[model samples]
Target chain A: MTADQTAAWAEQAIAEAAHEPGSAHPSREEQVLLRIERARRRRPKVREERITLAHGAGGKATRTLIDAVFVDAFRNPALEPLGDGAVLDVNGGRLVFTTDSYVVSPLFFPGGDIGDLAVNGTVNDLAVCGARPLYLSAGFILEEGFPVADLRRITASMAAAAAHAGVTIVTGDTKVVQRGRGDGCYVTTSGVGVLEREITLGEPMVRPGDAVIVSGPIGEHGITIMIARGELDIEADLASDTAALHDIVATLLDAVPVRMLRDATRGGVATVLNEVAQAAQVSVVIEEPAIPVRPVVTGACELLGLDPLYVACEGRFVAVVDGDHADAAVAALRGHPLGEGAAVVGVVEADPAGLVLLKTAFGGTRIVDVLVGDPLPRIC
Target chain B: MLASQIRELCEPGRQYTFMEVCGGHTHTIYKHGLEDYLPEAVTLVHGPGCPVCVIPMGRVDDAIDLARRPGVIMTSFGDMMRVPGGQGSFLDAKAAGADIRMVYSPLDALKIARMNPDRTVVFMAIGFETTAPSTAMTVLRAAAEGLSNFFVFCNHVTIIPAIKAILDSPDQRLDGFIGPGHVSTVIGCRPYEFIAREYGKPLVCAGFEPLDILQSIHMLLRQLADGRADVENQYTRVVPWDGNRTALDVISRVMEVRPFFEWRGLGFISQSALRMREAYAAYDAEVLFDVPGVRVADPKACQCGEVLKGVLKPWECKVFGTACTPETPIGTCMVSSEGACAAYYNFGRFTRSRHKETSRT
Candidate 1:
């Protein structure tokens, strides 16, 4: 479905939820999302310090509100399909399986929520692993007092998103928690996909001559999440690069023989690169200017004392491909819709062991290492 | 820039050494890769800046004792949770069901005391002057509020006397100094004048900024090249000559410098530690405990002392990555992120071996 069709489907789902039988019933996750959204607002008009069950109820009101606002804003085909699961048909036998949990604080954010996150997170997880995601299963942990209406709206989005992904969510389970025992909702999803026949992905496969490539910009997802949470009072034009990148990967695989593929997740590019270097026992060099970084993300990171390289990413991925195929790989990626701004950011070299080096913009070098303590907690 | 100056200073075919007393300062330099920018003749020695590195086994044992006591809620900075005491680290106690809390600041400990009135809250106050003010403020406020269950095990130490300890030692041979950015912000450049006059060593009060450090290095090198040693201030933006008077006043009024204290690596240093005043005696965790002795004992097969003293490089220590790492730290230096060995292990060690091998051949 196109954008308009998804928008229309989202409206119908919202309308159905609002006037459905056993309306005003929301699941724990929906209620939690609403409360976090309310709490994260600039001028919170608090009538009472304590939360009530009405917030979680997915009745006509809950359905109408979420559909009219959240679903309406993040309108997409899979999200609009509003089915129970996403289904896909793969032509290849190779597959990648991955999962991710979305427990971000203030579950609702500027550009996305747990619903969109559920689809994008699992899809990206598989995409980074060199898989063309084929299916997804979402699990929800709800609180007892959550509203049915809110539940309908959230589930509606989950269904529509699964449909849009061209994948099937064949199975799911929902558990309820006692009021005050849970924050709102927690989403754990598993994704399985068939890999491209020509691709092989792993750290050990990253030989000395392979190149590391990144699609689009870095730090947008992390910065967008930070801005959504109001952690650093900063604004940016960046949105969460929270989308499935299987199509982009397929395009790259069509031209280049990938040695290894991995997503920059919790530890960002630095962590992912370090892991690759250690596993392959190869020295890695990342050019500062080659890797794409949005000015907004860079400015906000500079203001908040965060390193863009270490920030998390949901949509982007790093590819280690054969040296001779580097240009062909770049061209393949550039031809795809998701790989327009792709670039070869670094290369693998023979190192003694457990070494990752980052050559700075100023013609100097620094070690890009993992964060010692918990990094920006509550960040997805 | 100091990098340029260091390059020029070595033109006379001489070597210059600089020691940074503050651990935070040392981390800033390493984090920014400023160390490599310095010319070969210039060496920035890691000093005793990490409180976790300097904390004796006895105090850690004291903290563990408080943690293990029934109905006692012990709080500490995250770094202190992992440093092993003679008995066990706070993490070991926590894993074994002790009520141990990790707090960002002492204020969090105050809130913990307020929330859990049924349990006694013992805060392990550890750090140099950079963190002493906050701990002192908490103790003062607890006394004022008459919070009966709130207490502090004072392990606060000053930087000047510790630096003086190094300078006064018979084997002292440093050419110049890159004074701690954070500690100097608290103690100011005034107190360091005595070191310059008595020791005749150039002192550059550098900030943690890469440019500030590089600039301070330039200043120190210029002084050394002229055969003139004096105290200089490079981080004047946040710090002042007089320092934070309010914080210093509170510290002076409510605490006394320990007559003689046993630092972990530097051994016994005069007037290096702080103890609570009589007015706040009720909130002193040390007084509350009846531990027999505060003895000095080194960890088995550890080179933390030499590493902390600037006499040994982290790589020179036998157990750098072999027996002691951040994962299983045998010494305090291996545990704390700011500790010399840890910084070297985390960011530079893998490359260090590579650089060494390439140079040797």
Candidate 2:
């Protein structure tokens, strides 16, 4: 059949399949045609009349809001990729710059508070881009009647975290809103880092057969914050895995050829995988048993009817490495304290491009699509 | 191991169809990729068990109306927040400056009511028998604490009547049943005996684990193979034979069955839903608030009713993946995470051919 005739035939077959009772399965050619049609229609746009909380979630809605609103308005070459940080060519030296804001509820949690989170989150963002995090700018939005003592404690923790990560807090700004306008305090941190490595890495660098490795057990920070809310009556002996990943990331880069890196913060590893798949135009197939998750986190997820794959992790990052050097990359990551639980979770595939599939322990495969909304609100 | 056993039990050219009457089972089936292991002759049909999916649009409109009221905080499970009504959803209401909160439990709404003494808090309670007891306990707790500002917009439903409705539907073609795991934990094995007795369909109460579902399917197939229909329990570790007596008592105390309630796709079933008891009228949102209890018809293009009844597959729906999707859902089946349509769209599409190839190998 001619190209136009084939397309017409595929559309007719799909229509017939939809109308026919019990004839749900489409032919392979028809499936391909439908997928192409879906892809053509799914160009990201902000369709919501008003911004909902989903716009703030680090998922599909957030991406759409950013792409449709922010990215479209500030269309520049450097900002197009929308990586955690922007790599700018400053004179002869390359520099990575990124900013993150923390609106975590409760202000305090099990392993770390919002103070340290503000510092580590930004440092890790720059670090994932193969940059040596150098300086940070801290900003605070405090509510009226907020205790000065609490402010002092938070700043002190941020200072300690910055020192540990070998970054200096060079500048800062503080603003106070009315009592009901703000939730105690909100912190925003922007970091600048120098690219010391000569190697280039990004989603475009990722190829088929690349190995996907996670730094550690996922969903700890998000689950810790959820339990600390004291709403669900679930008690688990767990703490947030909120440490900076610069050192572990540096070690991994030194040992092997790294294709891409992303810190699994707000939307966890699943969101990161989807981003990689879409950007690289490749499929990712991960084994369920290979993705490491704490039992407590799994229990919490099951009780709340949440997927562990989509739960956020503050200290964890997903890395795409050369398939031939996957083992060496894992060993190098394991030598560091922060990457002790690192393991090869999945591999990149050439066919069925731009999707992430999970091979379940039961030997079945299912698509792990991008998250639609904020399942766990204010979990970062 | 269970997959091979299930495959071996399948007789050549003999078809076996089983209905999993719970949304949780449907979720597990897709989540764990259980369909890959099942033989080609066996088919698992999704039933009308998702509370969020089964809720009618008119009820959602009423909840949104309650949320829009001044000085009122509408609370609901996160699953119900995005479900759209005639006007919009709780998320849309929240975006429009209505005080809508997503709480993990009904007790959290009571806590919110207590914290804000001047404001009224209304919990949009939803779910099957598994979650009704918790709402019942929360209501009793509110009564004990004398929380006058707290009220419940109870939409809790029972599982047995819905199951019976599915069985009585003329188009239902099933040989056995996979009972809901969590609901069975509360209502127990005794409630499902009616299916085996009246419908002559074998049922096995299954758990949520991959193996648990596989084992339940195996047990149901065995019962069918033996020419004996009986209700069995594969989740014996959690589900008791008679069910949780205290929870059943609590449900009876604070709530009573309504004569009929509207399901999104299944229409209204007799004594299928629960409401606040007369003694707890003061804490009932429906009694206290001005709710427009109107019925809204389902959209013409959406075939969720046939999908709910297993008469049509989710993909058979006219708007399954094109006009209706998880992002822009025109039907309830595409809104809830566990809904059959959402499950198929999110995970099941594009894997049928691959699954067949792997099974053959």
Candidate 3:
């Protein structure tokens, strides 16, 4: 039968099943069909048979894959929210833990390398959760024919990055695979931090009239990596904006009452805004000219058919604070080197909940949705 | 200023329907929300210009079949990877152990062929006249370098035939056209003269900027107000009257017009697509491989044909936002970013409600 025919048959069966009295139980065959239909609606399923690069991209496919496969099997209270990290309470002490893996190709780029990226990535993940990142663990996967000199250089950079972030590598693991089995190197880092603040920071705390501020210009890291691949012939003077944001984040927290903080890493600021809007049940309307983007980055993005709003940023973050304290937050962030280019980009609204709208320069508004597929492949 | 001028030329109690015959113009219109600046009397219709959106499913299936062959490395643009075929996409094929790579240009595909001398590198080429010159140049380079393993699965199409087909359709009520910017840079302003001479519709070749589009609309409105139907150029800074002679020469030397080719919504049009010339047969994948050139029908519920013909708005489609979306596309219209359905879904849906509110006010 055709798809339409099957759908019609299913609709008839569902209608017949619904007509039965509530107190009167249905027959065996009808019960089986009802149960199958209920299960099909309730269960989360990843429809793709095999995994693709989009599954690894921090987009819709990634969210579906994680929720259907990993979260369903490992369902727990701590893992339910599925934020950047998990906040644990141990004997009245608050702790935040997060992990990230770095599979960026070429190993090194303009401003930073994979080693520093792995350390800063996990550190920022913990820092954004209102924690003081203290300890981290590193794991390395090396190919059989990999060079020791390159490994030493990477480790040295990782050590310097950890020292700068005021964190220590307390533990590590190493494994070797066949020459072709692995990319030259892959590093995974896990971080643990203690939350000593007397205030709470989360999406639930967000409310209407909150101000949205972003630290520095966006799309530097993703664009730098894309250029470093040397695939396209276009030339631009750019570099990755990869840095540890714990100090700057602490400064903002000390200055203003921040409702939430999210590092615009994978999926960029647009994805983070969507998550915030959905979680807080509010609308986010941003002004196009207010968003800080470098001229060079904008040029590269236009040439590559990419939007700078959706490109990834490693060091930058978005913060939600009270509307009155928005100026203070930007002032506090601008005092730091990593956030010298911070500005207020948008505001939260009550109507049209769970959506992000961009007010164009031409006095028109449009929706800004989350990233759907891998436009720029594997930067972090 | 252009918006005010366009408003000054608007006729009362009459609607002017103009089609933007380029995907880039469609993207610019929605991205910058140009509709809000225009008078309600003027309407802009999307044309069948998105190359990725016009490719038939059967051709995608054929590309996938070629990728599945042993010792074959298939390469294509990144946007083409997610476009669903009859079975699956290139991304799905790659996950199933097929060596399908995404390259930014055809020269990169040729580079892969040079690096791996033992493997056959097939570049699934898809685009319109703007991109055909690069593919033709790459093919010429491969021949000059004596690279025997490189092949091109040509799917490049022309815009003139598709525009003619839209004009020939009885349901269309178009008044003017916004000629394609990039395609006009290659094929020039003369190719679009037939639209003005034969159909009495004014055509303006416009750039891909918000202001460029506004100026083009203003020009079209002026022509309509003066009762003049002529081909004009608003993007003279980029597009020449006769086009690039060197690029046109290269394209003609390497490629030839096919008898007919299948478009996703527009169907088959005679001499509408390009194929490798007999002299370059060795570099053509169609000549080297046994492709199952089977024709597949569009899905039952999809109204992309009507949408392409300008008879139905993107939002007027039955399954437009409900079942067909950028995330889960049931038709080719929702697959590409430049596609009309995707542009509407991404940026223009809210405009409908805004328009309603404005009308009520």
Candidate 4:
């Protein structure tokens, strides 16, 4: 079909999708949110209108908030689709499904936002499962009395991000809530795609002596998001490294029988490695020098009495695959723009299931365990 | 230079005992895995250095009571969050949405007061000289900024008084001291001279590096063999014969010596703690947050008091690995990575334990 016909057909399907879920979808409420004229006209009420945490509850109050604000703006082809789930067709006989919720304090942040986080987070989740992301479903929980301008900006970013990920937003949902009852806006997205042809995935298949690979430097996502929010006055120009990882994951999967993949989020590499070791019943030995970390993040961590090892990550992943396929996986990942700095970080061992040992450059070993407390509280 | 000295002086077979009286030193020792380098005979005993470790369970329960009061925005450093009170901790209250804030510095507590104009912000003021400067600065700054809502619950302790208390204890078996360099930098070397003269124990203010720790052990050994007791300065780079005058002056003015303070392991030591100077009552968290509860004693089987006084090793406490670890610390010696027992266990205490268990099985 021609591009125009394809666009028209997709638009029609989106309209039908939006009709059934007309009032509940986030994009619709966001469009109404962007109506600054109406918001300004009701200035006296706007002053009384402030977000409480309850707006994120997903109820009638949530609907009114999104309708009065966010849904008014950010109306787009993909977001307007309002589908139950974004249907993605892949080249192989497999399907991958993933979902995430973004409730970052500042709906927008440096390098990304709740929209960017929702899209990238969903895409990365599918990618780690060895499936290229095909399409995404975005649902927003907007606080009532939230500004229309912010809603438009966030949706626009999400739409741009979906295009970058080569995925179409086929469907979605929206809701609103009272001002004081919510903390601005929250976004949840789900993505589904097919695994590459004949590639098996999961941790149970991981064998000893297989190599582990990391996507780019660690802790940047955590440090960047922290600095962007102006929480700690860490004197460094850092931004969150939140981005889609499907492109790199696909490249690596194409060249290897990927045994397992997991994005290091919340608990950082320590948690990620520990999870892999326990799930696969294997030990992991990683070298400290091999794990890349930006100097500013390292310095900030040192100055603020924090550990770089236990820090959080929103845009990195740990991959375990066959030993013979290791070089090929590294090559494929390195070739991608997203995985330019990817490197072989560690190797699986036959002993000590559920343990992560980091060999320092000084010839010492330290256990990398899952962090118990929040690395940087209020971080995305 | 100190490392080579350690190599030359560290001979095997004779048991040597050393104690460090700073939580900072304890944390540094374990965090860097320094204990692993020491000879098997060289036992590094835990001192009553940790403020949270020694802050009696009653005080913790008291803090919890204050933390839950309405309009109270309680703030503290990350360390105090998980420390169990008689019933619960500040984190337990925080999880229940009691507005307990975990701040990096006392200044952050002051800043919280500046931001939360409507509520009373109480900084859970705990720590030694290393942490007290910031707390004092918070009080000074809050008063300067005219923030009426800001207060502090002063559980501040002094290193010298605690050192003296430990030395005076009947079970004191330490050969020498790995004198705390950070505290010495703040309070100066002169204060620790008493540890040498009065206790007749060799005292060496050591730095936090692995090499520095190894050398301190050597210094303690030489003093023991020579039957000499004196204060020495191995960390002369930072520590002076006298400490930071401005800080001492400020702390003295804002606070005064408490007659006696309750400690978890050490009980009450006269003048061991510092209290707000009456003038700063409006900013004292303990007073504003008045919650009373039972003075639950330490577990009967736990040897934490002996462990703190160097009379018993951490592993000797029956609860070292099985019931007490960093995960579920039954005593103060297990919670901090720097606690003498925690240091031994975290790095490789399990190796010995596993070996013993396998043999028994």
The DockQ values of the predictions, listed in order, are 0.05, 0.31, 0.25, 0.03
lDDT of 3 by residue, B272-302 (tens): 9999999999999999999888566677667
lDDT of 2: 0.85
Q: Which segments of model 3 are wrong by more than 4 Å? A: A1-45, A376-380, B354-361
* Worst ten in a row by lDDT for model 1 chain A: A1-10
Q: B1-361 in candidate 1: lDDT tens per residue?
A: 5466569866466777788887776666666556667666777788888888988766777678778888899988867876766655676677677899777678879888988999999998899888888888898888888798898988898888888877776765688888887877778889999878988999998887678878888888888778888898889998887788888988887788889777887888888899988877888887887644545366445678888878777766644544454544667887776788877765554333345333222
lDDT, candidate 1, A1-380, per-residue tens: 11111122223323432443333333433342233223222121212122222122222122334455667778875454321122233463555556667776666666566787788778766665666678888899987777777667667777776776677887778888899888788888988877556544577678888888987788787778878865344567777776667678777777778887766655578777876775577878777779898888888876654678878777788888998888888888888877788889988888644557766554345566555333321100
* TM-score (0 to 1) of chain B for each candidate: 0.95, 0.98, 0.97, 0.91
lDDT of each: 0.70, 0.85, 0.85, 0.68
Which wins on TM-score, candidate 1 or candidate 3?
3
Model 4, span B1-361: residue lDDT tens: 4445554565656667788876667655655545435545776777887666777766776777787888988888767765666555565566566788777788887888888899888888887786777778778888888889998888898888788888887777778898887777788788888778877889998887666766777878888778889888888888887888888888987898999887878887888889998888778765665546347666655667888887876656544443344433556666555566665554433223222222121
> Taking chain A by itself, what TM-score does each prediction score?
0.71, 0.90, 0.88, 0.73
Q: Order of all candidates by DockQ, from best down to worst?
A: 2, 3, 1, 4
TM-score for the second chain in candidate 2?
A: 0.98
Better of 1 and 3 by DockQ: 3
DockQ for model 4 equals 0.03
Cα lDDT tens digits, model 4, A156-263, are 988988899899899999899888877888888888876655655566677799998887778876677666666566557777778888877777777887887878
Per-residue accuracy of model 3 over A92-209 as CA lDDT, tens digit each: 9999999999999889999999999999999999999989999999999999999999999999999999999999999999999998999999999999999999878878888999
Model 2 misplaced regions, further than 4 Å: A1-33, A36-41, A376-380, B355-361
Looking at candidate 3, what is the lDDT of residue A131? Answer: 95
